[model samples]
Each structure stands twice: as structure tokens, then as C-alpha cells.
Target: MKTERPRVAIQGIRASFHEEAALRYFGENIETVECNSFKQTFEALQNKEADYVVMAIENSIAGSILPNYSLMMSYSFPVVGEVYVPIQLHLMALPGVRFDDVKYVTSHPIAIRQCIDFFDEYPRLQIVESNDTAACAKRIRDEQLTDTVAIANALAAQLYGLDVLERRIESNKLNFTRFLILTTHENARKKTGANKASLCFQVNNEVGALAKVLNIFAHENVNMSKIQSMPVLGKRNEYNFYVDIEWGETRQFDNAIKQILKYTHNFNILGEYLKYEEDTQAPKPAPSPESTKRYITVRKIE
Candidate 1:
């Protein structure tokens, strides 16, 4: 009997970076349940429409997505895994559309911002912001807009049958977005190599309260990889701290958690899973001849 493919919920349509991260984590055999917003992704998982959720938590260029942190606290789902996708923005349009023929360029606001240096030189092109990078590419293809181009990924160009006008056009080549793989508590199982964990807690307002919790982790030799503070809703001067920690030994992590429970108010372990290491090297440009043709013909705007 054939095995059933895992269904993953991601915040965007097909061929999006969210989908890219999902594929990287779960592989291409999984089915993608597209969602319009991050909250919707969680809802899908909550409603049993998806087996897992791939949600972007932070970006190297734009920093942490604060709203997602609130969502995590709201739903209280377990983050079972993680994947890092390099933010490689490409310019793509209908087949046979020349570089000089492009009049308008569109993409997600964040994607557009990353490619500002490239667009700064071309004052003739109008910049339009959309909700998803892949959605922009799909619109250009579905509408057959010859004069318009989209700033998206190579996957979008391939999926929509659009030709890549320019590859790796984003201003920052080193940019990357970290996505978390989340599932319902019942479906979450500890992986064999689980060495990292995500935790959130509330500490007393008194001075040294937060420091004491940190000292426990330090005392147990658990390395705190990341710490983010989010304001408790409708509660002034109160904050929830989200922390990611890695450990060399499971006993150290267990001991740290035991000690932290004494100092924290609403301590919650979001998940315990393998940590993903980001690739520092920039992605190579697309090797297609058509993708590189614009480099020789288009004059630098400056």
C-alpha cells in the first residue's frame, strides 16, 4: 500500500518561500495547504486540515516577526522542526518579454524592500506591493501581462511558466528566513537527535528575576541561542520571554528546565527538536542563458 503524504500548511500560495521551507523540511512528497496569513496556518493545523505548519519566524535582514511570537503563545503548538531558506529574489516575466519592455514590477513589500538597490536605478519601472512573492508571479502569468514583471523566486518562475528576466536581484545576497515546523501536541514526538528546544515563560517583575533564570541555564551549561521579549497583552510592564536553547547533553537541558520552573511563572516548553544550521554562503545565480541576457543589455541606473 502507498503511504499517505503529509499535508503541510504554509502562509502563502504554491511556489512561495513558505512552501520552499516546507519542502526542505518535509520533502516534496508532502501536500501543501496554502494559507493567506500566519494565523491561518495555525488554524489549519488546529482544525486538522493539515498535519503540520511551516511558519516563518525571523529573517536575517528584517529581524524577528513579532506577530508570529504572539501566535505561538496563542495557539501553544509544538515546534517540531526548523528550516532556513535563503531569500533569493528574482525578476521574472512572460516568455519573450524583453528587459526594456518591462513597465511595472511587483512583489511582497518585504521582497520589494530587499531589491530596492536594484530598482533604484530603474526609475521608469513602477513598484507595486502584493501579499505574496509567488502570487505576484502567478498574477503576471494568469493575466498574461507582458509589460509587468514579478520579483519572486526561481521556483515561482518555473511553476508559472514565466521566464526569469534577472536572477538573484535582491540587494542583500546574504539574507535568509528561518521557518519553524509546528504540529499539534498529540502529533509531536521527540526526534532521536533532539538537542535544541524552544521555551516561553513569564518572570516576576522584581529585579534579578530574569537574570536568575538565565543563570540556571548557564549553570547547567545549556547554550541560549536566542531570546525575544514580547509584551503581555493588556498587561503593562509585563512581558513573556521566548528563548531557544541548545545543549550537548540531555541531562543538562532537563536540569536547566527543572531549575527554571522554580523561578518562572508560566513556563512552557514550545518544542524539543533538532536545530538547523544556516548556510552562510550566498546562492549561485541561475545558469540559464535567458536569465543572464539582461546583464549585457541593461545599463546600470547609476
Candidate 2:
């Protein structure tokens, strides 16, 4: 029997990239809840207000989204799926406004940096920080800030009824963002041929202990994708290491993870999710919002 599509929560407003990722995974028109922050999305998922949460985990230009990684390991929610979106930034302002009329431009700091080329000539223009690029666009539209412009996406401009003052303004042409699809339950990445597994571990803070644990994967012929450490807050000098491993359709993945657990403490299974792009090699169109979806929020920044 086919299971019904699940309601999901995504951070940011209607035109946010996170929302686009959610739509791509869940299908457009499925129930969705908009969150003001990543934490709020986590809360919706944890409280069972929504069936799943989708969030940006990393960007090609911006490095890893540390907070999301920390959230992944801290929260009980498991990483189930991943979606990659090609990012094309646009400069927007109230309709009918010319570029010379612009007095201010704002966005998330990371976003401003991503499109530095478009901004360099107007360094004299005040740069302000908003929660995000889309949120900034919404503010400009809502307040009718005629002199103010924003660096965001075309979708944001379209949704907010703003005019694109500039196009593809990102410094890098290959801008793409990677987002994760998360769930409260395990086995989100049910066995499909050729999958990736995310796992966390904490060695005894001894020299070479970390490498020894990784050796297990080497012996098993598993491919490693990423490795990073986060300071275990309040735990003094102790940091947790996150790893992504590539394994073929074989039971050895489970066996290897199980064995690695013995060598480290806090050995947790982050998620065993399938990469949508890896198999399809094509992008999926976003689904419409699901009003009936349940949700839980994990983070909220005021």
C-alpha cells in the first residue's frame, strides 16, 4: 500500500530556500508549516506538530552550517534525506525603483558576502543584517522602504512582489546549497542501493584514538565524505566528531557502525538517508504547502 505524504516544517518565510527544499522533498501542495527560525522547525518536529523538518545544512560558499550540525547531534531527530538546490541570487527592491535610487541594501551577512561583487561599488551604502535574505525582502516590501534594496533570490522577489534590480549577483557562479530532511523516527533512509550514513562519535580525548576509530572504516572499504568536530558545550575541552560514510548495498555498514561504537562513547546514529540527487540526477519541482501537517520547532532566534 502507498503511504500518504507527510506534513513538514521548513524555516523562514514563503520564499526561503529552505521552503523550496521542503517542497522538493515532500511534493508541492503537501501540508507545510512556516517557521521563523531553525529552532522553531525543530520544536515543531519534536512536539509532533509536523511529520518532518527540512533545513539548510551547508552551502558551497559558506562552509558547514555549524548550528544545524550541533542540532542534529543534540536532538533526537534523525537525518533521513538530503536535497541540493542550485542558488541564484538576485538584487530586489520595491517595484519601479531604479538602482540609483537605492540608498540601503541588507541581507544575512553570509548572503552579503556571497554577492560581494555587486556591492563593492556601493560600499558607501549602509549594510544591515536581518535574520535572512527573504525576511529582509519581506521587510522592504511590508515597510515600503523605497530606497532600500535586498540581495535575495528571484523566488523571494516574485513572492514579495518586488522588482529584480540585479540578477545572478553571487560572486561564484556555482552557488549551491545542501539541505537535510529530518524525522523523529529511525530508519528514515530505508535500505535502497547505494546510500550514505551519518554517524557521530566521541573518543576518550586521547591522541590517535580518533584515527583508530576511523581505521575501522578503512578496513571495511567505506568511503568518507566529511569530518568535523564541535565543542561539546559545558563538557570542557571535549568535542564531538561527525562523519559521513559511503557504503554500497551491503550489511557491512551496520556491522562497521556497530563495531565503531565500542571504540567511542556517545556513539549515535545520526541518520541513514538517501541522496535525492545521487540517484535521480535531476531536480524535483516543489510541492504546494500542506496545511494539515504536524510540526515541532528546535531553535528560535529572536
Candidate 3:
């Protein structure tokens, strides 16, 4: 049976990375429902305004988008797939504007922080923050603001007819963002060939409880790619673990989950999907965000 093109909800305008990621995964025929915020993107799905949503869960440079994980846990949306897009942030502005003429640099706060080194050299330029990188470019083009430049993807420059003042200005050359493809439980259950799984669980506040759970996966030989602990609000010292594991043998992964359940409490399998595979190009190692302050400054335009 031929599947109908899905209505994809994405954060930001059509040229944003979220939209590009969606197209890369769902193809060109899918209809896009642009949302101004990530929360709104989930609301679109919940309200049946969209069939699926493309949400950025993490970035190589910025690390995990923690709030998004909370959103997933709250909305209970099933992750149907995943995509990793190479992020190339460019400095762009209206035509005829030179580097010296630019007084204000604006982009999504995360985008601005990724290019911090580039901005550090230009101390005179005041940095501003916007909700979306593509929207920043759109504002400069729509308002004919020559003094303001936007840091966004090449697609944003093309779509907004802005000139690229500088290309690949991000401090980290290996910058890439991973997006989660989400759908309702009914649609997600119909997916097949999943080799990776995302899970959430809680363990008793006792020594060796968590270790026992980890040992099960180790015994089963399932590669645990990522594990994050989010503190359960109002419950001191108790955390909800979010884990991602990849398995070559489905039977082994199944057995590991079965064994893990015996040691953990309130275990929830968030999703099972095919792992995202990039091209043969190797990524350069970037600084881990654990030591650095993840927060960025933002100045909204009135």
C-alpha cells in the first residue's frame, strides 16, 4: 500500500535545519507545518495538525537539548526515526553590505554560541538572539536591514536571497545536529528493521542497582552508545535514565531488555528505530559540553 505524504511539524521556517532534516528523511513531497517553538511543534502533533515532527535532540557542538528530552517524556510521542545533518552555519546579510557595515549579528542562541570564536574577533558587532536561524535571515531580508547579519545554514541564505558574508563560521568544524522523527504510537509500531533503541527507566535509590542494569546489556553485548540521567523533579537524588543502545542481534537486545526490567523500576522503551548513518567522512572531535556552561545569551528584538 502506498503511504500518504506526512504533514511534518518543524521548528522554524522552511529553510531552517529542522525542515532540511525533515526533507532529508521524509523526502520532498511531505507537507511542512512550520512552528515557532519546539513546544509548539509537539502541540501540532498532539492536536493532529501534523502527522510527524522533526525535532533536534542534540548537536555535536552544543551537546544534548535537555528540554527536548523532557518534552518527549511529557508528550509521550514515539520516535519513529532519526537523522543527522551536517551543520554549516554561514554569516549572511543583505546585498552590498560589508563586514564592517554589519553592526548586529543575530541567530538562534545556540547558533550564535557555536560561532563564538568568530564573534570574538569582531568585538564591535553586537550579538542578538532570535527564535530560529532561518527566521533571522528572513527578518534581515524582509525588513531590508543592511546593518544586521544572520548566522544560519546555506539554505537560509538562498531562500532569503541574502549574500553569504562568511561561510562555515561555526567554531567547531564537525558541527552536526541529530533530529528525532516522531509520530503517534500507532504509526511508530508499524515501522520495521530497527537496530537501535531509546529507553527511559528509574532505579531504586540503592548502591549497585544501576550497575546491575548496565551489566545486563554488557552481558548481552549490546553497545550502549549514550546514557543520560535527568533528575526527577520533586524527587531528590532519584533520576530518570535515558539510554540509547545499538544491537547487531535483535535476540540479544531483547534478552538484555528482559533482564534489565528485572533490575529497574518503571522502565519504558521510548523508541526502536534504525540508527542514523552519515557519509564516509569522519567527524573531527569537538570539545565536550560537560565542562562548559551550556547556556547562551539572547537579546530578543522588540
* lDDT of every model, 2 decimals: 0.85, 0.77, 0.83
lDDT of 2 at 91: 90
The top-ranked prediction according to TM-score is 1
What is the C-alpha local distance difference test score of candidate 2? 0.77
- Deviation of model 3 at 71, angstroms: 1.5
- For candidate 3, give the lDDT of residue 3: 34
lDDT of 2 at 20: 69
lDDT of 1 by residue, 1-302 (tens): 11277778888887789877876676546667888788888888887888888999999999999999999989999999888888989999999999998999999999999999999999999998999999999999899999999999887887788998889999989998999999988888999978999999999999999999999999999999999999898999999999999999999999999989999988899999988854532333332334323221211111
Q: Count of backbone clashes for each model?
A: 0, 29, 0
Error of 3 at 254 (Å): 0.8
lDDT of 1: 0.85
How far does residue 116 in candidate 2 sit from its true spot (Å)? 1.4
Judging by TM-score, tell me the better candidate of 1 and 3.
Answer: 1
Model 3 regions lying over 4 Å from their true place: 1-3, 279-302
